[model samples]
Target: MPTRDPDGIRRVTDAKALSAMANPFRSRMMDALKVDGPSTASGLAQRTGQAVGSASHHLKVLAEAGLVEEAPDLAKDRRERWWRLVDPGTRWSRAEFADDTAALTAAYAAEALTLQRQFERTQEWNANAASVPEWDAAAFNSQNWMRLTPEELGELSGEIVATLLRWSQRTVPDDGQEREPVFVFARGFPAQP
Candidate 1:
């Protein structure tokens, strides 16, 4: 297993858990819980624009996979059930599942879904960027092409992740500043396109 970070990023090595989290809805639900904190099925449905029953079902699946857990303390009454992410985020590499063909397929599918979600979010922001001109200067899209060996590429990837982790761990001041969730993602791989 990979080393745990201070930010509580869970390293998933189990094939069953990887397969369980490979669903698009489940992935989004996990992200929602991580960002918005514990919430009930109805609240998750509202946030995800999914049916309440669908949200509930997915939450149960996630719980079974150990990605999320019930937050009894956050519930207002016995009837209310709240769910929260077991960790701030999850980390998995296809390399870990190389021995298992099925697990490797699941990991690939999960990675594809994640890339799709990131692209969709970027497109949505671009479409409505004019409505919030304040973010214009900060919003950015960047890419570069470089020649490097596998080892160098690995080092670069590690540095990028470390940089993002540092930023993620920073404490936002409670000075009434208008701040919203920001999504950050990066990819580095050998490309011949």
Candidate 2:
């Protein structure tokens, strides 16, 4: 189960909750809610290429797991229901679920699917890179291999999230001002045993 931290983050630490989040549809719905704010099942269905009923089912599954919750305020009508992410992002330790091979595989597979989707998005951006000169110039995609103690790796991960959260808190636009959303991803893991 997720517990709200002092910072108002619904941090998920339970293995069962992580397993519940391993489904592709549920994962996609969570990402959509995080990226696009509150929306209805129909809207998410359109975005995810799933039927409305399928989308609704996935949304309910996520809600049961506490990754998302109904946002009645965003609903446009009595018939429509709006949902949003409980947290803008979630973190889990694979090691915690490792003992349960089935759950661990599913969770890892979901992450792999997410990475593949991100790669596709990057390709799409590459196709349009020339039109957005500023973004193209500012974008980052680099990798380096280095040795680090496990403690150092943990600190690095925490620092990255802290920095991103500081920026994410300011994403709301000022009056009449327009801004674009930017995605920042970091992958730091030991490649050698």
Q: Which candidate comes out best when scored by TM-score?
A: 1
CA lDDT, every model vs. true structure: 0.85, 0.78
| Residue-wise C-alpha lDDT for candidate 2, range 74-148, written one tens digit per residue | 776898799988786776666767678865775686578768878888899989999989888988888888789
lDDT of 1 at 109: 80
Clashing residue pairs, backbone N/CA/C < 3 A, model 1:
none
List runs of model 2 lying over 4 Å from the truth. 4-8, 14-16, 171-175
Weakest lDDT window of 10 consecutive positions for candidate 2? 6-15
**Candidate 1 wrongly placed segments (more than 4 Å):** 1-7
Summarize candidate 1's per-residue lDDT along 1-193 as a digit string, tens digits.
3345665778877766787788888888888886788999999999989999999999988888888899999988999999988776788888888798988988888888889999999999989999988887788888999999999998898788878877876787889998888998898888887
> At residue 125, what lDDT does model 1 achieve?
90
Candidate 1 — what's its lDDT? 0.85
